[model samples]
Target: MTTKPDRFARWLPIAASLLLLAGCQAAKYRTLESFGIEKRDILGSRVEAARDAQDDAREQFSSALEQFRATVEFDGGDLEDLYDRLDREYTRSVDDAERVRDRIDSIRDVAEDLFDEWEDELDAYENANLRDRSAELLRDTRSRYGRMIVAMQRAEATMDPVLEAFEDQVLFLKHNLNARAIAALRSELDGIEDDTEALVEAMNASIAEADAFIQSLEGSS
Candidate 1:
């Protein structure tokens, strides 16, 4: 008997391949509609994807910050090993940031398509009251989505400076692998703390927005 994890592991690649194919096919609106996925459902899924991406990003940033903190508190060690660890963290952080950016772009793309379709459909509605109600819903959804994306973008922006700081420190340590470098990093602790805290706060806000957006969708559904 195949265990759940074993079955999942066996099908993982197949599942991934199917998802890729589906995404390619779904690029066509007709394909999406043929699959019975509505614009609102697409938006909801995209929003959730963005939220999960943001969650991953927040955790990655926090992990990187912790790594930096550990480096700053370094008493004495093999400098090369220290650089290796820091380098790994920096690379992971960069990858996570890129994923977050891509997720946000996906959300934006779906939102634009959704809103355009919605607006065009509004013009097709014959009943005046229905048209008016749909227009109002479109406006409200757009406004809420705007707030969520803005918060997500703001959090994303904070990542650049933080990543730069981490890179600079890593590069500096790579060259000057000595006690002096550790002391210098200790001096930067306050600034790094501030940046990390700000990032967490922004991420929290974005997550709250995501929760609210999801709740709104659920309520309507």
Candidate 2:
């Protein structure tokens, strides 16, 4: 005769499944850090990600500028190849800028959650002096974050006009593949050069701010 399964045996699979689900959720929603880390640590991680994104953007813009220079300065060396290079740079730049924008969004999301949690915890403090100090720190940190984000966003904003100019040049090169095209590009070289330079300057300022923000976080810890 077949015997019925015990209750413990029947529940074992369910319990294991629940545990697995919990692990997956923990890994997915990693806003809360491990090792009992607090919101500050999460903020630090976001800062690092933001810094990395900006660095990536800086490198991409630099590379795109180089390719753009190549396109304009093409001394009749493989016209098609020059167009190909410019097209590639334009596409890569769009992708890289998207990543930068996504990273900034992530930083903003985490900052909102972290600040909310911190503000809520302010009410849990029993000591008035300590509570006041925590409140002040919260404000200070928020202000710093605001400044850093503004710098990042300013840098990000500069990319669009540069990209627009690149797109126009690329389209022009795509159609006019001759000496006249080269001459046309030469005429536009100064304008493109100025835009790229301005973009680089904006990126440099943002990069410096990112470094300062990261250093502040490190110093805090």
Per-candidate TM-score against the hidden true structure: 0.86, 0.82
Query: For this target, which candidate reaches the highest TM-score against the unseen true structure?
Result: 1
Report the lDDT tens digits of candidate 2 across residue range 49-124: 7778777877887888788777767776788887888899899889988988988887787688788878999999
Candidate 2: stretches off by over 4 Å: 1-31, 34-37
Q: What TM-score does candidate 2 get on C-alpha atoms?
A: 0.82
- C-alpha lDDT of all candidate models, in order: 0.81, 0.76
Candidate 1 structure quality by residue, lDDT tens digits, 1-221: 96433544465455545555665534544444544555666677677877888898889888888888888878877877877888899999899889889988888887898888889999899999999998998898889999999999998898888888999998899889887778888888789879988988998899899889888876765
Give the range of the ten consecutive residues with the poorest summed lDDT in model 2: 1-10
Q: lDDT (0-100) at residue 191 of candidate 1?
A: 90
